[model samples]
Target: MGVVADRVVSILLANGVMGMRLWFGQVRWVYRQRRVWVLPAVIVLGAVALSWLVPYLDRRWAEELTRLPTGEFAGTFDASVMATVLSAVASGTIAFSGFVFSVVLLVIQFGTGTLSARMAPRLTQDWVVGAALGTFMATFVYTLLVSLRLGARVEDYQPVLSSLLAIGLALASVALFFTLLTRVINFLRLVKVLESVSRAGARRAAEVHPYPLGSQGDTDVDLGPPDRVVRHAGRAGVLLGFDEEVIAELAARAGCVVVAVPAIGDFVLPGAPLFEIHGGTSLAERRLRRHVVFGIERVVDADPAFALRVMVDIAIKALSPAVNDPTTAVQALDHIGALLLNLSGRELGITHIRDRAGAVRLIHRCSDWTDYLSLGVDEIRYYGRDSIQVIRRLRALYLDLLRSCPSERLAPVRDRIAAVDDDSAAFSTAFDRAVATSPDWQGLGGPAPIDDRQC
Candidate 1:
C-alpha cells in the first residue's frame, strides 16, 4: 500500500512538472511571435522567476537559523520577524499573481494550437477559448501550490495567509482572463460583421446595372454639374451625370485600382447609361461638352499631380509607347493629393464621395457629379490648390531628359517620339527655373529638353 502511494505521488509530481514546462514553452513561443503580447509576457515571466527565487532565499535563511544556537535566539527571529518577512513575501507573491493573470489573458488572445494553426481560415473562436482555459488552469495550479505552502506552516496565522493568497490569485486570474478574451471576441466579431456587409454591398452593386446617367443608352462622362443635361435619345431630363474621369482620378489618388467598373455611384436603373470608360477616344464626340471632357470635371481642379499622374497612367495604358507599372505611381500621387488636401483644410469631400455621401445628401446625389448638381454650380467650380513642387519636379525631369539627348543624333523618328520643338519650349524654361530656385534640384544635371512622351 505504501509503495502504491509513493508511485501515485511520483506520477502527480511528474505531471505537475510536465504541465508547467508545457505551459511555459507554449507561452514563450507565443510571446516571441506576437508583437502585441511581448511586453506583458516579459513582465509575467519575470514575476514567475522572482516568485521561484524568493522561496529558495527563504529556505537558505532558515538553514542559517538552524546552525545558530537554538535556544539562545529561539525567539530572536520571533513571530514579529516571521510576520514581517512573510508579509513581504506575500506582497511579492500577490504582485507575481497579477503578472500570472495578465499572461493568461494574453495567452488567450493568441488562441490555441500553434500560431500558424490558429491563424488558419478554418480555425474559429474555439481556439481562443481553449488558450484562455489553458492559462486559467496554469494560474489555478500555481494558486494551489501557494495554498499548500501556507497550510503546511505550524504558525496559526499561516493558514489565513494561504487562504487569502489562494482566493486573490484565483479571482484575479479568472477576471483578467475573461476580460481580455471577451474583448478579443467582441473586436473580431465586429470586424467580421463589417467584412460581411462590405462584401454583400459590393456583390449587390455588381449585380445591378451601373447607376444610370441618361435615357439614351450611352453613358455620360461629364462629371461636373450632376444636374448637367445628359442627352441620349435626344430627350433630356436632368439625369445625374458623374464625371467618370474625375472619379477615376480620385480613385487613383486614393490608391484604389479598377474603380469597380460600374463604380460606386453609377445609376444602374433602366434607361441609364452603362459605366463610362476613362481615356477612351470612343467618347470624344459625345464624351466632351467642349474641349473639356464630360467625365470628372471636379478632378481638373484637384491636385494637379494626382490629375497629371492619373492622365499619365491613362495615357500610358491607352497611348504611351511603353506602359510602366502604374500601381506605385498611383500610390505616390494619392499620397501627394492627400497631403495637399490636408494642408488646405479642405475636406475634398472624397470620403463622402466614396462611401457615405448618400447619408449626407439623402436624395439624388449618388456621386460627386450628382453632388455638384445638388450643391449647385458654385460648389462644383471650387478646385483645390495645386502642388507647385510636384509640378516643377515633373517639368524638371522632362527638361533634363531633353538636354541629355541630342536631337541631331537622334533618328528623326525618336525625336518625333520625344515630341520636342517650339511646342515643348516650356519644358526647358520650367526645368531651368526649378534648378535655379529650388534647392532640391541643385544636384540634378543642368536643365535639358524632354519629350514627355508615353515612351
Candidate 2:
C-alpha cells in the first residue's frame, strides 16, 4: 500500500513539474513568434480602461480644463457635437480596421505565392501590422465608449479630455495606416524579403551556435547501450526545440546521460524513439517529453537550420521551370551565402551539455558546417544548371566562401567549387562552359579571371 502511495505521489510530482515547464515553453514560443494578438489585446484592454477613467477625470477637472489653452480648443465641441464627432470617429476607424484586415489578407496571399510559403508566418506576425490594427481597434473602442458616455448629458458636460484623446487616437490611427502601407509595400519587394529572411537566419545562427569554430573541446561521451529508450507518445509534430538545461538537470538528478534521438526541426511521430537513457536510473518519460517542445511547423527561434531551409526553398522555387527566374535564384544565393558566412565562424554539430558537476548529462544533434553548405548550395546548383547567371553566381559564391571560411571548413567549399566546374563542363559549347565556369560576383557583366576565361 505504501509503495503504491509513493508511486502515486511521484507521478503527481512529475506531472506538476511537466505542466510548469510546458507553460514556460509556450510563453517562450509566443514571445519568440511575436504573436499578433498580444499587442492588440493589450491595446484594446487599455482603451477600455482609459475610456472609463478619462471620462471620470474629465468631469472632475472640467472647469480647470476649460481654463487651459488646449482644453479651450477641446471645449469648442458641445455635447451633441462631441457625440457626433465620436460617432464619426468610431464608424470610420472600424471601417478602417476592416480595410486593414482585407489588405493584410491580400498581402499575405500575394507574399505566400511569390515568396516561400514558410514566410507566411513572418508576414502575418509583422509587428507593424499588429500595431496598425491595434491602434485602429483602440481608437474605435475608445471613441465608442466615450460617445456612449455622452448619453442624456447636459450641453455643458462635454468630456473635453476624452474628446481630445479620441481625436488624437484617430489621428494616430491615420498615421499608422500610412506607416503600415509603406511597410507592406517594402515587404512585397523580393530583395526585402530575402534580406529579412537572411537577417533572421543570421540572428538564429548566432544564438544557437554562439561558440566560434574550434572553440569548444570534443563533445563526445561514451555511454554503453541504453538501459531504456523512451518513445514519444504524443501526436506527431516537428520537434521545435528542447530545453537543454532542464533536460540536463533531470539527467543529472537521475545520474544518467540522456541522448536525444531526433534533431530539432525533425518531424517526430507517435511511437518514435525520443530519448536513449544510458547508465542512469530510469526517468519519468513524461518529464523527458515535457522539456522538448513540438509544433506543427518548425520555427527559426530555435532551429538555426530552418532559415537556410527557407532560403533554399525560395531559391529552388524560383529556379523551377515554370518560374525559370535565375536572377531570383542568384539573389537567394546571395543571402544564403551571407548566412553561411556568418555561420562559418560558429561552432556547430552534436552538442554535449553537462551539469554542475561537469558530467555530461545530455546529447543532442545540431547542424554541422557540411550540412549547411549542402543545404545552401546543392538544390540551387542542380535546378539552375542550365542558367549561366546562376552558374556564374554559384562559382563566385564558392570562391568567396573559399576565401573567407575557416581552414578546417575549406574542404566543403572546395568540393562545391569542383562540383560547379563539373556542372559547367556539361555545357554544350566551350565558350558557354568557360563563361559558366568563370566566377562573376555580379553573376554577369563583371570581369572574370583571365585564367578562368582561358579555361
Candidate 3:
C-alpha cells in the first residue's frame, strides 16, 4: 500500500508540474514568439498520456512475472510487490532518460553546434561529471538493497548482472554506429559547397559601403572626431539585437549614418556590423581607439510633465551642497519650466543640467535612444553595470574642479555635458579609463579616441 501510494503521488506530482509549465507558457503567448506553444502543448499531452499508460504497463508486467513458477523461493512474485519494484525501476530510468534527452535537445536547439554555444561548455562539463557520479552511486545503492532483500550474495547475482551488462553494451554499440553514420553523411553533404558560398557572401558584404550625412565626422584639423556612416539597411536589425546602445555608440564614434531608427526598446540583430567607420583602413587600424562612451542612457516613457518635475527635483539637489546657489538653481528651474510649456501637447526632447553644477542631464523625446528602446532592446554593448563607477568618478572630478579650478573650466563642463549626450561619448571614455587596470574591463568597449573635435 505504501509503494502504491508513492507511485500515485509521483505520477500526480509529475503531471501537476507539467500542467503548470503549460499554463505559464500560455499566459506568456502574447509576449513570446508565435507558435512556440504548439510543440510544448504536444509534449505536455504526451506526458499526460504516458502517465495513464504507466499503471497499465506495470499491471501487465506484474501478471507476466507472477505467471512464472518459482522453484527455490517459498513465496511467489505477488502482483503488488512485483508491480511496485517494476514501477520504481521503470520510473527512475524513464525520468533520468527524459532529463538527459531534454538537456541534449535544448543544447542542440540553442547551440551553434559548437562547444561555445548553448550553456557554457564549463557548466555542461560539470553536469556530465555529476551525472556520471550520481549514476554510479545510485546503481551501487540499488544493488546493495536488492541483494539484502533477496537474501542472495553478490556472487549469486553475477550472471543476472552480466546479462544486463551485455544487453547495455549491445544497445550502446548500435546507437554509436548510427550516430557516426549520420554525422559522416551530414559532413559529406555540407563539404561539397559550404566553402565557396561562405567566401562569396563575405566578399559581397565587404563590397557594400554607404556614405554619410554632412559634417558628421571630426573636422578638427589636428585630431578630428569619427566619421558617421550607416552600417546596415532599414532599422529591421534592431528588433533582434543583443545590445543596440553599443551599436549606437559605435556608430556615433565611427561617424556612420544611423539609418534604421530602432523603436523604444529592442535587441541587436545578426549581420548588423556595430558601426561602419568611414575612414576605412585608417579608422580600422585604430578602431579600438575611437570609442565614444555613453553611460546608462536609459529610456523611460513617462509624461513630459513628470519628467520636468524630476528635473526640478534634481536642480534642487544640485544647489544643496555643490553650488550652494539657490538663486541660480531656481532661475534655471524657471527657464526649464517655461521651455517645457512649449511642449504641453506635443512630444519634447531636451538635455540640460539636473543641478546648477551637477552632471549634464538631458530630458528629451524622439531621440535615437528612445527609437532604439521602443524596439524592446535593452542590452548595453559597451557600458555595463560597472558604469556606475564612471558616473561617480565624474561627480568626484566635478567636486575637485569646483574646489580648486576656475568656474569656467571647459574640460569639466565638457565632461558633464558628455555624460548626458545621446551619443554618450564622454562618459564612455571616463569609464574605459577607470576600468583599464581591472581584468573585467576586457569585456567592456574599447577606449575613447584622443580627438575631441566632434564634441
Candidate 4:
C-alpha cells in the first residue's frame, strides 16, 4: 500500500508540473511575445461586469445622492446629467482610443525605420502601454453599458455613483493617453531606446552573474564524462529559461549534472541535444524538456547576450552601405561602452546552478567580456571602415573599456585598437587618415579639435 501511494503521488506531481509548462507556454505566447491585446480584452470584460454591478451598487448604497435637493445639487446625478456624462465618456473614449492607436502605429513605423527593426517587434511587451490601451477601450465599453440602463421618464433612476465612476475613468484615460504619447516618443528617439535596452540588459546581466564574495566552495563544475544526451522535443524556438528547482529534483533523483547544451537565446533546432547528463548513464528527455522554456524572442531574465544581440543588430544595420548612417552606429557604441564598463568588473561565464543538497544540478553557458566586445563592436568597426566618426567612437570605447577592464583583458582591447589603426592606414592620404585618427565626439557634423595626445 505504501508503494502504491508513492507511485500515485509521483503520477500526480508529474501531471501537475506538466500542466504548469502548458500554462507557461500560453503566457509566453499571449503576453510574452508581441501580442499586446490580452490585457485589453480582460479589462473590457471586467468593465462590462462592473457596468451591471455599479447601478445596483449605487441604488443599494447611494440613494441619498440621488435624492439630494435640486437647488443645492443642480449638477448631481440627475437623469439628464447622467445621460450627458455617459454619452461624453463613451464618445470621447472611442475617439481617444483611435488617436492612441494612431500614435502607436506612427511610433512603430518611426522606430522600425529609424531604429533597429529587430527591437521594434518587442515594443508590445511594454505593459504600461498595454494597460493604457486597455483602459481606454474598457472605459469606452463601460460608458456604453451604463448608458443602456437610462430611462426616459423623470421618475426613473439616475446612477450617480456609476456616472461619477465613468467621469473618473475618463479623466484617468486622458492622463494615460498623454502618458502613452510620452512613452511612445521616448521609444521613438533612437538614443533613448538604445540606452533603455542597454541599461535593462546590463541590470539583468549583473543580477544573473553577480561577483562572488571570496570563493564559492564545493561547486563541482568539472563533471568528468557525459554519459548521456537529451535532444530537443516538439517545435524549435529560442531557449528562454530553465526551472532550476524542478530540474534540481530530477538531477537529484538521477544523480547527475544536467548541462544545457545550447546557450539561452540560442535557436534550438529540432533534434538538437538540449542537455548532456554528466556522470549518469540514463537521461529523461521528456521530463527535462518541460522545465526548459522556449519562446519566439530572447528575454532578459537570464540572457545577457539578447541585449548585445539587439545592440549589434542596430549597429550593423546602420553601417550598411544603403543606410551609411555612421552617427547612429557611434551612438550605439556609447551605450555599449557603458554596458561593457558595467560588465568588466563583474563575474561572467557563471554557469553553475546548485540543487537543494548543495549539489550542482544545471549548467548554463553565456558570453564573457571578449564575446561581448566582439558582438558589440567588431562587426560595426569592420563594416564602418570609411566612416571616420565610427572609428573615433570605437577608439573612445576601447580607451574607456581599457581603463575599467582588468590587466589580463587589456591585450584583446589593444589588439582591436591596432586593427583600427590598420584599417585607417588603408586611406592613402595623411589628411584623410588624420580625419579617422581622432575620436570625433561631434561625428560628421561639427568636428572637434584633434586630441593628438590620445592618438
Maximum-lDDT candidate = 2
On residues 344-393, what C-alpha lDDT tens digit does candidate 1 reach at each position? 21111222222111111111222232222122111111110022233333
RMSD per candidate (Å) reads 25.2, 8.3, 25.7, 8.0
Candidate 3, residue 74: how far the Cα is off, in Å = 21
Name the best candidate (by TM-score). Answer: 2
Candidate 4: stretches off by over 4 Å: 1-34, 67-75, 151-156, 212-228, 279-287, 300-302, 356-358, 440-455
Runs in model 1 lying further than 4 Å from the true structure: 1-138, 151-157, 187-455
Q: What is the TM-score of each candidate against the true structure?
A: 0.21, 0.86, 0.20, 0.83
Task: Please give the lDDT score for candidate 1.
Answer: 0.33
Candidate 2 accuracy as TM-score: 0.86
Candidates 1 and 3 compared: the better one by TM-score is 1
Q: Can you write out model 4's per-residue Cα lDDT over 350-386, one digit (the tens) per residue? A: 5565555556777767776788778877888889888
Higher lDDT: candidate 1 or 3? Answer: 1
TM-score, structure 4 vs. true? 0.83
Better lDDT candidate (2, 4): 2
Each prediction's Cα lDDT score? 0.33, 0.81, 0.31, 0.73
Give the per-residue Cα lDDT of candidate 3 at 86: 37
Q: Using TM-score as the measure, name the better of candidate 1 and candidate 4.
A: 4
